[model samples]
Target chain A: MTYIIKTNNLTKIYQGKEVVSNVTMNIKKGEIYGFLGPNGAGKTTFMRMLMSLVKPSNGEIIICGEQVTPTSFELLKRIGCIIEYPVFYDKLTAKENLDLHCEYTGYYNKKEIDFVLDLVKLKDTEGKAVKDFSLGMKQRLGVARAIITKPEILILDEPINGLDPIGIKEFRNLFQKLSKDYGMTLLISSHILGEIEQIADTIGVIKDGKLIKEVLMEDIREENTAFIELKTNDVKKVAFEISHTLGISNFKILDEATIRIYDMKASEGEILKTLVVKDILVEAITRKNHSLEDYFLRIINGGGMNA
Target chain B: MLKLIKLEIKKFKLFNYYKGVLIANLGFIAFLSMIYFLERNDGNIPFENFEMAMNISSAAIRTTFIIFAAVLIVKLIIDEYKSKSIEIMFTYPIGRKKILTAKLMIVVAFTFIMVMSSTSLMAGLLYFAEAQFDIFPVELSFQDIVRNVYVNFFYALATAGLSLIPLLFGMRRKSAVATIVSAIFLATVTSTTSDNINLFSIIAIPVSLGVFGILIGYLAISKIEQVDVI
Candidate 1:
């Protein structure tokens, strides 16, 4: 497989504390790689290291086949990014901010600026300074600046931050189009699992400053491990029925009144019938396919079967 | 490198603080001219000797422009850190050293231009006043004019160079107040030294400070490529 971004045991240490510990991951071309982690989990640090905004204490970052260093500036021309929050010259208008960004990147096409502004829905904000912009507006302008140059790779650290729900949905579509139509690779970090689940081609779960798993979204979908969840009145009665009467061995009692049967061979109708016969009231029964949130939590909890 | 400098100039063209500084410099020249006119005849005034007048005027103008230089350093360097815009700039396809060099060059060059132009303009006005009103005992000489220009040019350069000391401190700490305070401190010290020192030492003091400031500036720039921006 051809990888657009590859890191070899990347590590960042601040004041002798490892903020990012030996993280080795790869991002393929034309794919949205979602970096999921809790707050202060080194997601921002790892992204900064890739951008060379922060020096890595150990390991190497390879972007588009070239190793990244402080002097590897020419290689950065192909990359666009927004680290942490979108920052701009507050005195400059949104348009001027984008113009300055384009000029710095050595790409000057006025039409491209207009195109990106329209793409990010910031076209009407022509005369207003960035200081007057709302958080959502600034977020949109930030996206506009990042995409103005039509870079080959985009590394966005919490790009959808401060956006409304509709704005988030719009950006999700925009990201998908950018990846599918423009063939741009993206490395995005976010706490929004559903959004990441919807857009990402691959997901990397990080915990305690270490990357615990890098799995393809497709693989996660295929290995979803469907389970039948039951909310009952008598949890012990249901558990006994599921084990002795139903002959189902693969099951877990989640709480006082909830049970999940992982055995795919067990029929839901038979399980319900046995529970009803035992005078156990089934309040809600749901057959759920494991979601990215589940996988993320499992990985974080150190119970994930695959890494 | 030239392109980077040009880009810096373009970026600052619309900056309000930059325009404000330019206007303030012009205002300062006018104020200084009025002071010279009002106090020309009074023994209490310090423009009794041609050399002393030139030194005092150059020192005053240099002090004002040095403050401007410090302001520029805060706007261009420290503000980048405060606003977190340096992260975006650092990720661009340009060397950090080049960007910093361009910003420092702008500060130094701006200080030189402002100080030189203001000093020369005030000097011309002083001479014009002297010719019209016979305000002082010592008449203006062509040689005095030439020496004043030569000495003030170097003085301006030194003042501009010395601005890097504040810039260094500010950039290291990413503090606007620190940068401004240091600039003011340096300007005051230099101005006091120029006033008390002999005529021969006027050019020597600022030139030495300028050269020392340049050394520190270069050291600061050299590390831009290696140090973490945060």
Candidate 2:
């Protein structure tokens, strides 16, 4: 796959502390690359480096095949970004802010301004100054501004921080449409996995200022093998019933109240029938995939030890 | 460069400051009138000599516009850093130094224009008052008027440079209050020299201060590319 953005040993140091250390990452063209990390995990710093807002102290970033020196800002013309949070001339209207953004990026098609506002549901905010805008409205407008130029790559850091549930869903659709319809490359950072899990083609989990894991969503999907989950108050009774009644050996007792049978040799119905025959209370049982959620938790909670 | 300057003005809505300028002019005129009435002691008027009158007026004008320029610097540059909006500007497809230069240029142009207009206003008003009231025994000749303009031009240029010094203080801490306070301090110390001291009375001091102020601006942004934006 041809990469549209690449970084080699990309790092940023603040006061002798490496906030981002040697993050050599690749992003393919027209793909949604989700940057997943908790708060203070150097996600914002990494995005800032990619956006050329912060000069990397000991590394290099190549975007569109151009090395971004302090003098070279031409590559920025092809990028749209909103770092940390959306900030605008507080006195100016949302429309005015978007227009200025377009002018700075040298994208002069004024008509697209209205189109992006409409897409982000900020079209009704005509004369209201941005200072009066609610945080959610500012977020919507931030997205509007980022996509207004139809930039080849969009670097949005924690773009969904203050959105309502409906707004998050709408943004998910919008991000998908931008990738599929306009062929835009997106690098979105979020601490919440649910925000990125739905639409991201690739997810990069970061921890303690380092990228712990990077994997394709397809590979994650393929690795989600089926497993049986059984919940009961009497874990000892269930463990005895599970092995004795079903002769199942590949199973794990998670806690006093839960067990996971990884082997699929026994069907759900047979296991439920055997539990009922043994006069044991099977409170709940269901077949669930070892989800990407588990993988995200393992990497995050383990602090890269598992990775 | 001009477009970048214009963009800065539009972004900050700086054109709305005309009202403040008008108010300053009205207050300046009132202040000069106060000096005219207050300094007349038993037929010994300060305006009897043209040089004393011009010296007092220029000092006041220099202080007002220098402080005004510092306020503009606070708005145009310091506040941007404080609010972190400068991150947005840096991400744009423009050189960082170029953006900073445009902001400082606006401050300089504003200091120059406001100083020139207000100085002329003060000069014209002084001439009109003398012509109408015949208060000064000294002649308000065309030569004096021409010289006033000439002297005020250099003062405006000098004040423009002097205005930039506060940028050094303001940027060091990225504080708005610090910027304005330094402006006041600089204006007072530089313009309040007694006549016998003969230090601030000459053009050389303000000119040197102006040049030093310009250097301060250069020093602030010299490492623009290498330094962390924060």
Candidate 3:
């Protein structure tokens, strides 16, 4: 597979501390690569480095087959980005700001400006100054500007920071359309795992300045471990019966009232029958599949084991 | 580079600053013309020394241009840093040096236009006051007008160039107050001594400062690629 964006040992040091340390990842062309991490996990710092907004302390960034250096102006022309919060000339109107952005990028199509504004649902702003805009509106305008040129690659840092549910859903659909219809590679970072889970084809989880895991969402879904969870009254007696009677070692005792069976050797009916026979008062039992949040939390807590 | 500069100019909501500068420039001219008129009316003041009038007028206009340039630098460069808008500009495909150059060019050009226009307006008003009131005994000549225009143009250019000095300090600290304060201080110092200096020194001092400012500006631009955006 051809990679549109690749980083090798990308690191960023600030005042003797490595905020982003030795992160190497590949983003395939036309794939939506979601960057998932906790707050202060160096996701923004790494994205800034890729955009060349922040100089990397050490490592290499290859974008569209060109190494990103301080002088990578030509390479940057192919990428659209919103680093942190969107900023604009507050005095200028929304349309004016977008026009200025187009001027700088050497792409000026007046009709396209209206199209993008419509895409972001800012079509009726009607020359309102940006300072009067709400945070959500500004974010939509930022997205409009980023997509105005129809760039080959898009890098957004917390793009949905202040959007309402409807706005977020619209942006989700817009991102999907951008990638699917235009074949544009996207690298988006968000602290909301569910948001990234819904749209991202692959995910890169970073923690403590390290990129701990890069996994395909498809694989994660396919390899999802479904387990039986039981809530009971006699927790000790239930644990003994489950292990001694069921002969299943791949199980975890969650709490005083709950036990999870990861090994699916026996059917749910058999397990319930065994528990009932032992008089373990099972209050409730349900089968559940491991979610991306669980996978992410496990990776974060376990130092990247089985990612 | 020229296209970048043009884009920068277009981005500026010129009416906001231009209206203020125009009113202030006209007010300064009226105030200075009144002072000249009053001074000539006094018997002790020499009315035939056109050089002194030109020198005083140039000093006042130069001070005004200095402040104007400082405000422009603050708005164009320092405020961008404070508001973090420059981060967006930095991510663009254009070189950081080009952006800096465009900002500097706008400031210099604005200062030049404001200063020269105000200086000419003052000169014309003073001449009309002389003709109407017959306060000054000196007869204004074409040679004097040409000399005044030539001297004021160079002086305004120099003032505009030296405005970059405060820009350097402001950009280094990313402080608008620092930029404005330094410009006020520089203007006060430069304006006070402008009266005592000979014509050669008036041209040389600001010219040398302009060179220094340009050097500092280049230094700032060179560092733009390396510095981390906050």
Candidate 4:
């Protein structure tokens, strides 16, 4: 498989401190790569390097088979981005800002601009000045501007930071649809783990300016490490049934009315039906798993301990 | 480069709030002409008064145009730097030096148009005042008028070039007030003190402009190309 983004021993130092230590990472074409790290973890720095907005102190960055450099204008034409905050002239309307971006990219497509507006659900705000826009609106306009040119690679840094839950759901759906249907390779950085876990094909975790791990989501899922939770008044009965019927006993009682079936595939409806037939009233049944959040905290805490 | 110029023009067309600068230029011209018209009607001041007023007004117009051009362009550039919008331009599929050159070209072109219009407007108002109030016995020759106008335009361009020095030095400082003060101080000292030096005044304007333009252009190209935009 051809890699869209490849970094070899990429490192950056500032004022005698290594802000981004020696690191290597690969992102395949047409893959949704989730970059997860805490604040000040050099994710933005690395992204800037990839876009040729910043020079790497050491090592190499190859994007789309071409070496990244300050003069890599041809390579930049293939990418779109929102680094740090999405800024625009306050007096300009949404359409005007997008039009300006189009001018810079030398792509003239009013239809594409309108399509991206509709995609980001900003169609109603065509004429409204950016100064009147809320933070969420500004962020949506940023995404619309970034994608208006139909770039093959989209790099968004905390794209959904100020969005509401509805906006986030819309963004998540849009991201996945764009990647799958439009064949766009994405490098999205976020501190929100649950969201990344849902859509990312691969995850790159960074801690203290250094990449700690890069893992495939398929491998994580195939590990069979997920747990299921059952809520009921008869916790003991459900635990017994889970152990007896499923033949698995590596479980824990979470509370007075809840139990966790560890690392097992317990069907939600069937398990509830079996418990109902056993005269055990189940309130709710949900899959419990070690979320990306849990894993991120674990790795960060581990790094702290090692330090 | 053309695309980058288009982007800069779009920015100007969309978000220009300093309409005051434009009005200030016209208003000063109108005020000076009105003063000349009133003086001519009353016949209170001598012919030397008309000459002096004409000289002062011409100098004021040139100075105002140069100041307006400098502040407006430098402010726009500095604000982009402060808000970090220059990063967007730098990462766009265009060379950094080309982007700077495009912006500089836009500003220079815009300045030329504004200066030309303002100079003509001042001349028109003065001509009308002269015709109405019967100010001086002798009319300025057409050739003399055109020559002076061109000279004023060159003065504006040279002063605009000089202003870029403080702008480049003070961009990272982020204080427009300080930049303007330093620029004024530098301009006053440089223009008035050519007496102590043996340098010829006729050769000084182009040489100074060339040196300053080259220096600022170099700083901008190097900085924009190497700035870490994160």
**Candidate 1 structure quality by residue, lDDT tens digits, B111-222:** 8887888888778877877789765678778998898888777777777788788876887778999888988988787777444474326557666788888988799788
Kindly list the per-residue Cα lDDT of model 4 for residues B77-146, writing each as its tens digit.
7667777787887778878788777766665655556656666666666666667876556675667567
Clash pairs, model 4 backbone = none
Name the better of 3 and 4 by DockQ.
3
Off by over 4 Å in 1: A230-259, A263-270, A274-289, A303-307, B14-46, B193-203
Candidate 3: CAPRI quality band: high
Compared with the true structure, what per-residue lDDT tens digits does model 1 show for residues A207-231?
Answer: 7788888999899887778899999
lDDT tens per residue, model 3, A1-102: 899999999999999999999999999999999999889999999999888888999999999888998888878789898888999999899899988998
Q: TM per model?
A: 0.90, 0.92, 0.91, 0.81
Q: Fraction of native Cα contacts kept in each candidate?
A: 0.87, 0.77, 0.89, 0.89
Model 4, stretches more than 4 Å misplaced? A224-288, A304-307, B14-22, B34-54, B123-134, B137-143, B146-150, B180-210
RMSD to truth, every model = 3.4, 3.0, 3.1, 6.1
Candidate that beats the other on DockQ, 1 or 4, i.e. the better one = 1
Candidate 1: residue B109 Cα off by (Å):
0.5
Error of 1 at B61 (Å): 0.5
For residue A290, give model 2's deviation from the true position in Å. Answer: 3.1
Per-residue lDDT tens digits for candidate 2, residues B115-208, read 8888888887788888888768877788888887888898888889879999988988898898999999988887784652334577679789
lDDT by residue (tens digit), candidate 4, A76-159: 889989987888877888888887888778788777878888889899986789989999999999999888898999999999
Over B44-148, each residue of candidate 3 has an lDDT whose tens digit, in order, gives 663455666666677777787788888888888888889999988998898888898888888888877887888887778767766787656677777987888
The candidate that wins on TM-score is: 2
How much is B216 displaced in model 3, in angstroms?
Answer: 2.1
Task: Give the CAPRI rating of model 1.
Answer: medium
The local lDDT score (0 to 100) that residue A49 gets in candidate 2 is: 79
Docking tier of model 4: it is medium
